[model samples]
Target: MAESKPKFLILGGLGFIGRNLVKHLIDQNAASKIRVADKAIPETAFLSDHFMQYIQHPSVERIQCNLSNPMQCTRAFKDDHFDYVVNLAAETKYGQDDTVYKQHIFDLAVNVGRNVEEHKPLKFIHVSTAQIYDADKKPAKETSKVKPWTKLALYHKQAEDELKKMSIPLIIIRPAIVYGPADTSGLTPRFICAAVYKHLGEKMKFLWSADLKMHTVHVRDVCGAILHLCLRGNPGEVYNLADKTDTDQGKINDFLGILFRIETGFVGSAMSTMAKLNMKSTVEGVNDKHCQPWSEMCKAASITNTPLSPFLPQELLYNTPLSVDGTKIEGTGFVYQHPMMTPVLVKEVVDGYILQGMFPQPKDYPRPTPIPPPSFETK
Candidate 1:
């Protein structure tokens, strides 16, 4: 007789990482039944056709509920005994009010954590961010100084601290700038900016030094690590999930240049420092140039609607390095599928949106071939 597939419960299942995780489980045949609990439904999530097909897979069970509400969160876990419960729900937007973070992120995570204690899954995985560390030249370890540069990171750190007090079997994963399909917040903005610059026929320049540390990891690796840790990680352990690449702003720009066929550079620190002194004006100046031209490009292509945009919130526009060390997770015998970011991989992100008709097709950019999901390593 074969072993029964592990049952899974995924909180925030329709989110960027949530949807991707569900797809990963289905592709690997890793789960018997995946109950996806989230506030938003699939039809309203603006998922691509490629991702939509996977979310609607036979093994997935979608349940729409507000995890922020304590009653709903408790009921979400009472439905079945799960082998693994991964929490991917949170307020991901930057530059929001403190109240917003309190209600949606810090409060909601606590609510879910309390309920997880009652249900008692084999492993309760909590997704955190690399931003909890202070921006520095050195990569941060799990035990690094807790000086979060962003408000979102502050709340995540708060939640991490709170969740530690509980008796739940917890495994925390902190990932560096996660980039891939269904990524609206991470590197997608820069991709949109590159396309905008291509349309304007100008060199794309950025604030801060080109060598600023901007570590990254692919979404596939994130999902793989989550599953790997679910089976093999120690309770009360925290892991940093990043790739081998020591990616910097310049490295990312080089790939963007290749994809958009445009020139890219950074304003020297002298000018960038001045810009930072007056960040509000600087942010408005940057967003002002991209928004109108992007609209014009979409209009020319007859694309009346798209989720893609070149807007960067003030918090993200700040000159803070997000360097993170990923070597720790490797000690657990898990390997990254995309150990490094490449020009082709960066181009693949833009091409994916283009294929989905969410992004304006670049001139001379060939149609993208369907990318096969690489075999996930659970061992």
Candidate 2:
């Protein structure tokens, strides 16, 4: 028997992940209803044609309102009567302090929780990050201690636990260094810049202990997991979605050095920088500048002060050791299509971001050709 399609409400539908997933749902589940709502209307035409196509089915709707307001939530429920709510709404960066986070990051999580509890959403998939995992503890798993440092991590755990406690059907997916099309977040752009420098035979710089490990996943795979969970994930559970490759700063950094033919090492480590600065903050600062216009990138580089947070063996950002225990979600018959990194997939998403003029499109490098399979390492 064919299963009936569940109606969906993507609370932050116009954002990066939301827009991507909407594209997927449109391409595949032609009959399923999807409602996209975001407080900010998209400034770019990223979703116009796709949105128009999806809305013609008489099932899709778009709402622009403050979801944090209970009345708005109530009205949405009454108007749409959706069965699934996939929340991609979040303030996901690492460095932005508490200001932007509390107002939007934590706010959206809590609002979704309230709506799920009130509406008893058949399934609520919360997008989270693996950045919160204790990097000190290698092979971070679903059972690993969650000592979240950033405001974003704290809110993720709070949102996850609260939903579980309330007995709302929920799933938490912790992704590592999420990349792919439309990522203005800076990870992939740095990769591109390095490639450009290497391709041009310029010596690109590398920062951080190359031995330091990091895990990653493509954005589409995240959407795949959400769809899989919507169909089969158990309520009151958590899943860590990760790429099969156990990436480290060394492997990728060295690869970037080779590919871009540039120098790859901490400014101070093998080639020490001046006093009062660490490799990480310095390196991150240098790379983030690639996303900006030439004048802007240089101007910002001239004035930004060194961050005070010590590189004190923190599980904060450097550690990428992760194990994606999708056992529960897998038990529900979900297998990631791209279990490991595909440079091509990563390139595609980054290019999408560039086309949309999202931040982090470093002009240092032209986009590399799409990477083929065997990108993920099993180590």
Candidate 3:
């Protein structure tokens, strides 16, 4: 007799990470059937052309429903029996108020947790942010102290707590700033925009200390990690997903400056200090102005209408740097495809954005040739 194929359900499948996960599953032929539930339709979801084929594929099902609504979530899961259910739905905007975060992020997690508890899928994987950890320059472990320095992290921590209280077996993954192709959220697109604006000589100053650590994981690695956890991860265990390389804003700025061939200067500690003095009001004011051109560019490029906040709240920045120890996930026999955010990787992402019309490559921009991944050295 032939074995039955595994079925998977991805809530928030239209999101930056969720879309990539769906593509990864389909490309790997890992599932017999897949269901994608989200509040946005394919059009409004701002999915790239690469995803259109999968969305139209016979084995995939796209259901549009607000996961925040319990009745909708209930209906969405009523008749489906999934081997795996991955929850990527959450309010990820960085500048929102606590009330907004609690309602959209925390409440959504509770709703999904309750439904997962009821459905009892074979495995439940929840995507979390690295922001839960305090700003320590050292690599943070899953066992590290969780001092949420931002409202976004605070609410996500609350959501994690709510999920822990649920009866369903859960695998929690905390990922650093995720970037790569098809990335409209996080830092990728914003960096692209900054490069464009810088090339145009519109914005020339970096916001925070250039030395601030900027831990990151590629979206594909994130997908790979999620799959690894689903198959081999122990239930009720937490893993931090990040690369071994120690990347900081200074390194990123240098790369961007070289890539764009534009000389830029850091804003320095004095300005950052003032910004932190009145963090909320200052960030909101600056971000609102920045969002104007960003929104316009996104609209022109058909990308998702994501807000353009390059930095988190000032208080969060002043806290310890949010670096992490990804050895836990790596020890599970998973290797990062793009371990370090090298120049080649950054070029690939920028090229992807240019292809999508989100970024305009400068006429004189020197495009770096693609390089193969580095060979891992064993101790």
Candidate 4:
């Protein structure tokens, strides 16, 4: 008899990466059944109809539960045996209190890990952040020093440590600034900021040096890596899921400049130092500048409510670099379909929101180059 396709469980499946992963599995026809367990439902997730069809596919199942609670975590898994369980659930917000981070991040991950250990899936993939690495000039390897820059990263590191001790076949993936369609954090905020500048018809300026690393990986590549690592990667190993972009602030701004048709620049060291001294005020000022214009654009477009926002937290505004080495995953024979950060790719993200009516598509801006349909044909 022929073997059955793998049974998959995606925790936090309503999230950006999780939803994309579900799409990947369905597109590839890789899973016999996919169970999506998350705190939110499809209606509230702000998922595009393009993705809604995939989530509501005949092979996919939806479950609602908070993974932070142990009872709900157990309920999330149920009695069924899943072949692959990917944990994408966590408090992704920045600038939260220690207790919020503790309960939602560390506590949630431990609860999920304990449940995973009990069920013992074939492969348990935990999505982590690359922010745990020390901010340095060089790219951080998986074995790099664990000096978390933000409170969010601090708990991620702690969760990683605890999950490491579990007897389950666990594989950890730390991605650098995951961006693409349905992204609120990551590059979307910067895109919105550039849009604000476009409306103002002014050059966009950043606080830090142009060279500050803000390494990025597309969400498609992130989803691709998760599946690749699940099948071929060794259990009990950690992998970094960065692209070959070598993306820094300058590269990102350059792409944004071309996409938004706005000039981009950075403040010099002296001004940046002053801004650093009063970071709270600086961050507030920047956010204030962007939010008003963003709201105006939404109003002009007749959009009542949108999940997208230009408001950036102070933690995200800091100069800390998220440099990471994606070559390790390449060594495993997994290729990044979207290797570089390009203007077209950035435009693609904006275009997705525009199509969803979540973002204003300015009539004054120049027409964008025609983009081909999303493809992972590189592999």
Candidate 5:
């Protein structure tokens, strides 16, 4: 049996998800101790006094190290001898070239896995991405067919394969577009873009068509899922941690417009097509290969019984036949606390970014959806 409150070492512990996990673990008292490391933690104003409070303590240690460098990676594992090691470190961009991604980032995933195997921890948790699922489907589960092409998808897939081959007892979690307070990557920018557009009172058109799907989850919820898997998930198994609802691009846009009080319009089809038609590699001259720096127009939307909106970008929804079946995790007694709705997440992320001052304010930032009181979203 696993020791109660195992000591944890989190290699990618300072990135968006890593930070959330550390915060959550502290608040919940989920671990005996946590050692966090990353290439370099970017300094941001978004970190609050509360965040600073938690950053340094007897219970945690933060380090600057690159995992792709095997010597640095091996030294961490040998020095710590931790009970659980979560590899949340990855170059999580969707619009970058193959060479840039593999060299600087993705190989880091394999490196972490190798170190975990060498260290022989009680459990190794690999936080991966759901991009591996073929965009042709929506709400894809662990059983979903794998697609090998997407740059984002391949990175995690390769990591999983390499780790499994090494016989590491791992818990792999693939989450969709994640957003919430303190987010430095992914959908936060779209909110910044939308918020600034709202402030400017400028009419902005979405790059993707109305029907595309953009699955999302709150950063806190993703943290919860990771904690749950660490506490109770089956090793050598994979799970998809995403919004309960399979939300689409059109719905996300309409909701955000309503919440922010902006008149929103959408462009149709994939931005890739838009780029192709324009004879460029990207819309707005942004390279699709390095999609990590910003959010991308993902696949088409999936229909779901759960209604998640009132603030999501509708045009951003592309249909993804992927549907994540979380029954196994549910069976393991895992529970999700957040509503997994777009508006709810959008509110948290947008407000958090504004508070951080990282998001630039536009003169006409639109305030369409009247800010809901904290009690409004009460489940």
Candidate 6:
């Protein structure tokens, strides 16, 4: 007799990370069936052609429902029995008010946890963030002190606590800054744009300490880590997902400089201290010049509006180094295909924007071939 195929449920499947995970699973022939539930509709979500094609795959079931409402979540999961239930849904916008974070991050987790508990999936993987750790000069381990530096981080911590109280078999994953192809929200693409435009004409200057740690992981590795945990991770264990490299802002700038042949600099910490004291005027002045080109480029590409200023609010600038340790996940024999952010990866992201028509290519810039969709494997 042949074994039955595995069924998986992905909440918030239309999101950046969710969509990428779906693609990986399909490419690997890891699951026999996948059901994706999200509030987004493919027709109106402004998804790229690459993602649009996957959402329409025959083996995939797309469920259009909001996961925040308990009744909605119940309806979504009531009839389905899944081997793995991965929750990637959350309000991840960084600077929102406490109320918004509580409703979207905290409440959403509780609603999903309740449904998963009742349905009793084999494994429940909840996506969390590395921001829950306190800002320290050294790398943060799984057992490090968790003093949330932002309201966003605080709410994630609260959500993790809520998940623990539920009777579900849970594995929580804390991912550092996730960046790769099709990523718009992470800092990598933003920095690429900043370098491109700042070299073109704009004088958008910002200040940060050169040593500020900015740990990151590729989206592919993040998906791989989640899959490994779903199969072999110990219940109630937390793992920090990051790359092998200990990256800082200055190093990122240097990479961009080498790629685009542009020089990007930051004011020293002493000057940054004074600027923080008068952040309002400083931010506004920088935004005034920065927004002009960004707004123009966004309009050209038909992409949604992006805030003109690249400078984050002083409060959001939690400069405490975020050197996260990924030894636990690596100890499980999972290796990162893209261990460190490299020039090729950076080029792929920049070219992705161009392929999507989100940015204009330079006259002499050689466009790389578009990445083809992964072939579906038959077991």
What is the TM-score of each predicted model, taking all chains together? 0.96, 0.76, 0.87, 0.95, 0.80, 0.92
Could you tell which candidate, 3 or 6, scores higher by lDDT? 6
Pairs that collide in candidate 1 are none
Candidate 3 local lDDT, 1-379, one digit each (tens): 1126678899988888888888788777678888999898988665556666666666678898888888888766867798889999888776688788887789888998998888888889999889899678888899999998778889889999989998988999999888876665566644654655654566456567776787889999999988878878888989998986677777777777767777766677788778778777876776565556555555655766432334434444452576988888877898898888876677776775565555645546666344332122212
lDDT: worst 10-residue window of model 6: 305-314
lDDT (tens digit, per residue) of candidate 4 on 1-379 = 1138888999999999999999899878788899999999999999987788788887889999999999999998896899899999888888789999998889999999998888888899999899999888799999998899899999999999999988989999999999997888888988998888898889999988788888999999999999998889889889998888889999999998877778999978998999999999999988889999899999999999898888899988888888999889888899999999888788888888887889888656555444344333221
lDDT of 3 at 214: 78
Ranking by lDDT: 4, 1, 6, 3, 5, 2
TM-score of candidate 4 against the unseen true structure: 0.95
Q: State the lDDT of candidate 1 residue by residue for 5-81, as single tens digits.
A: 88889999999899999988878788988999999998889788777777777677888888888888887787578
TM-score: model 1 vs. ground truth: 0.96
Least accurate stretch of 10 residues (summed lDDT) in model 5? 299-308
Rank by TM-score (best first): 1, 4, 6, 3, 5, 2
Model 5 / residue 211 / CA error / Å: 2.6
Q: Candidate 1: global Cα-lDDT?
A: 0.88
TM for candidate 5 is: 0.80
lDDT of each: 0.88, 0.61, 0.76, 0.88, 0.64, 0.77
Two-way TM-score contest, 4 vs 6, winner: 4
Q: Please, what's the RMSD in Å of model 1?
A: 2.8
Worst 10 residues of 4 by lDDT: 370-379
Better of 3 and 6 by TM-score: 6
* Model with the higher lDDT, candidate 2 or 6: 6
Query: How well is each residue in 90-181 modelled by candidate 6, as lDDT tens digits?
Result: 98676688888998899999999998888999899999999899888688999999998878889999999999998999999998888887
Task: Give the clash total for candidate 1.
Answer: 0
Q: What is the lDDT of residue 126 in candidate 3?
A: 92
lDDT string, candidate 2, 24-79, tens digits? 67656632678887776654425433333443345557777677665675555565
